[model samples]
Target: MKYTEILEVVRQYIEQFYDAKEDSTLTFHNFAHTHDVVTHATKMAKHYGLDERETFVVTTASWFHDTGYYTGEANGHEQRGAEMAGGFLKNLGVKEELIQEVQKCIMATVMPQKPENLLQQIMCDADLYHFGTEQFSERNMLMQEEVERKTGCKIDNNNWRKATICLLESHFFKTGYGRELLEYGKKKNLERLKRKETRGMMRKSHIPNSCLGE
Candidate 1:
């Protein structure tokens, strides 16, 4: 089956299986995020001259990256996504060997889990492209919301800022293209952090009595 056909099947599965009304995992793991990952993954794969087989496998993995969210498992979502991907691809007449490759790509995206192959590395970087993009602020907010909503973790301003800073500090790009092109965006994120710290200081400097005209 063609990639377009496989994507359509994945879309249908997300719509039919993902319960948007649910307040847990399915709430924020929407189709738009999947589409964004796939778009970036495709672009990166093409730019890097990935073979067609690798491209198809990586793109399929991208489409199913968040499938575990629908299953309500936070930690093993990559494995769940891989399982779902295998089934979806099999239905699309994808060969057994290619399906395994796609599954490997899916599993390679798990956080704290290192990618074992080049295709995996590419998809992993593509998954995190937004972190080094101009829209990183807004994208990070969505992720925080998803985590808070799903896990009931209340992230205060201080903790959120600290976590964002740490992520920016530790993030490493897998592809040279991503590193070269996305450096400016990462700098912007750093600047955003500095501005946040400055704003906090300014707020602290203000006197409540001044506002009351004491």
Candidate 2:
């Protein structure tokens, strides 16, 4: 089958897979997030003028990169996702070479993303594209909500901000396109978060000791 046909099949399969196993706790890593990653991957692929086969590899990987979230564990979702992609593609008669490429792309999205090639770098940047966009705030909140819901613990707002700031500070866009187009926006978002954290601390400092039962 053509790569386009194969990609369409993968898309449908992933959609159905998520639909069949609905989990409300997956506020962030659901079909919507997968679709967004695919969209961002496509955009970056196009920016780099990737050929049809390369585009297919990156796009297909995006579709399956988070499938393992459905398996009820986020710890090693990237490995599980790569396995799922390989198995599904193998069943579809995809060549072993292409299947491995797709698996590599998916694995590149693992935390502290370590992408060794351009395609892997595209996948990594696409997965965290929101971190550099205007949608960062909304996406970040959904992720926070998902984490709290899954762990059954209310994360303190100040602590969440601190963690988010650390992430923003540590993250860098791997692709040139990402650095050129998204880096400024990411810095702006980081500044906004820092300001919020500062205001939060100031507010707490102004509170009376009596209110703290001291």
Candidate 3:
């Protein structure tokens, strides 16, 4: 099949998979997030001048990267996603080499992401693209909701903000376009979160001992 046709098939399969395995708890890792990542990957691929085959690999990987969330537990979701993507592509008669590349791209999205090549770097950046977009606040809330629902615990807002700040500070965009286009927005988001955290602390400190119900 043509690369375009293959990509269409992958898209359809992933959409249907999400539909069939719908989990309301996965507010942040749903099909919408996958589509966003695919869009980002496509944009990055074009900017980097990836050929048809390379684009296909990255695009397909984006579509299936978080699918493991539906298939099993969140831990090692990347590995599960890679296996699922590999199996589906193998059935479609995709070449073994290309299939491996797709799996590698998906795996590269794991936290503390270690991408060995430009393609993998694109995948990593695309997965976290929202971190640098205006949607960061909304997406971050949804992610926190998903985590709280899955774990059955209320996350402390101050701690959550701290963790998010740590992530924003630690992560760096790998591709040139990503660094140039995303860094400023990411810094803005980080500052916003830090300010919120500070205000939350101040609010708590100003509350009287009797008001605190002690």
Candidate 4:
């Protein structure tokens, strides 16, 4: 199938099937994020001169990577997304072999699961392309908003700082291309987190007497 046709199908499926409550991030994880991943994956594949099949798999994976959020569970969203994407693609006349390959790429986005293969690595990196972006803080804020909207929990400064630190410490880009491209931005984000934490601590500890102000 043509890439454009496949993309259009995916877009239509997302609009028709995405459930905001079950997949809280569904609002933020709209077609724009899918498009971003596709763009990033394409760039990485081109940079490394990936085979045509590998590129296709990654492209399809990018299109459906976040579809699992609609499943209402964060733990296995990738797998669920992959299953949904595969079914849709197969119904759209995509070959079974290619569908499986695309599903593998979709599963590569799961946290704590590193991508061992090159194509998987690219898809994984593309799924998290924001980690190294200059607008990392803004993106992180959006993530915080997503969580708040989904779980109805507000993240205060200390909590947000802690979360940011944990994310920065835990996240690792599988491909050398991502590391080389986004490492510094990731570090900058971490540094910002550290500063925020410090400021929060200082504010909490610095209570002053009213008489001292006079």
Candidate 5:
């Protein structure tokens, strides 16, 4: 299939499905995030010299990935998203082989990502491109809010900062294209997060003597 045709199909799918089942609580996994992934995936596909068919698969998978968050299930959203993508694409007359590849691309985006090939690697890195950008902190805050709302358990600043630090230190873009494009920003973002975490710890330890019942 031509790129324009499949791209439009993927766009329409996102608009209709997301509108019908949009979860207001999923601040971080909403349409904007999906769009970002698709945009980044396209860039990486071009950089990696993906053929037309491979580009189609990557874009389709990116569009439908994380859709299962609308289902209100915290765990296994990747598998659920893959299943949703399979059914939708199959209904659109997409070949079984293409649909399965698309599903694999979607599944490969799960955290601690394990991409088995170039296509999967591109999509996985695109899915997490925000981790290395100036918008990382803004997106990070939205993620924190979503977690707090969904779990109904407040995560204090210190705990959240520590967890965020660990995640940034552990995360990396899988593809060479991704690393060359994002590694500097990723390291900068990590430094910013480390400083933030340290400041948070210091704040917690700095108790004022005025409140000591003197």
Candidate 6:
């Protein structure tokens, strides 16, 4: 099979797997999210003038990146996803070096992301493409729902707002196109988060003393 064909194979495989394993609770990591990330990665790769082989590597890595969620392990999904990618590419007769690049791309997407190279940086940015876009709020709500369903833990609105604000303030997009497309929107999102936090605090302070802790 051509290396080119592998992308389609991967795309079909993940869609089928997700269909078989669909969980409404996993709103954030479902097939739609996967497709969106891959699409964003593809666009960035094209913008950055990735050759065909580089495109294949980045896009294939994007395909398998989130699949470890199938194993129900949230903590090490990157390693699990890399292992899965390695096995799949091996069966496809992909080169050891190419497979390693793909694995590295997968691993580079882990939170507090540290992407060492251009391709890995694209993977990281694509994985977090939503963070700097108008869709951040809607996508975050999906993630919140998934977390609540899985962990049965409730993070109060104030805490969630504070955490999100911190994340948006600290995050940066690495590539030129990444920053071009996302940085301004991310700034706006941060301001919106701050405003929302302020409103929440004001509402809390306005609550009558009867509900306050003694």
Top-TM-score candidate index: 2
Candidate 1 lDDT tens digits, 94-180 = 899998988888887777547887798888887888878878887778878887877677888767888788877777777787788
**Number of backbone collisions per candidate:** 0, 0, 0, 0, 0, 0
**What order do you get sorting by TM-score, best first?**
2, 3, 6, 5, 4, 1
Worst-scoring 10-residue span by lDDT in model 3 = 174-183
lDDT tens digits by residue: candidate 5, 1-214: 6667867987997889889987778889999999999999999999889899999999999998988898759799999899999998888888999999999999998888999999999999999898888999899999999998888889996788788888878888899987887889989988987888778668756867676444
Ranking by lDDT: 3, 2, 6, 5, 4, 1
- Stretches of candidate 6 exceeding 4 Å from the true structure: 208-210
At residue 162, what lDDT does model 5 achieve? 83
TM-score of 4: 0.85
Model 3: C-alpha RMSD to truth? 1.4
Q: Against the unseen true structure, what C-alpha lDDT does each candidate score? A: 0.78, 0.94, 0.94, 0.79, 0.88, 0.89
TM-score for all models, in order of appearance: 0.82, 0.97, 0.96, 0.85, 0.93, 0.95
Model 4 residue 61 lDDT?
Answer: 87
Tens-digit per-residue lDDT, 29-120, candidate 3: 99999999999999999998999999999999999999999878899999999999999999999999999999999999899999999999
Model 5 has an lDDT value of 0.88
Q: Distance (Å) between predicted and true CA of 164, model 6?
A: 0.9
Residue 195 C-alpha lDDT in model 2: 98
**lDDT at 102, model 1:** 84
- TM-score of predicted model 2? 0.97
Q: List where candidate 4 sits over 4 angstroms from the true fold.
A: 1-27, 208-214
lDDT of 1 at 5: 65
Q: Which ten residues in a row have the lowest lDDT in candidate 6?
A: 1-10
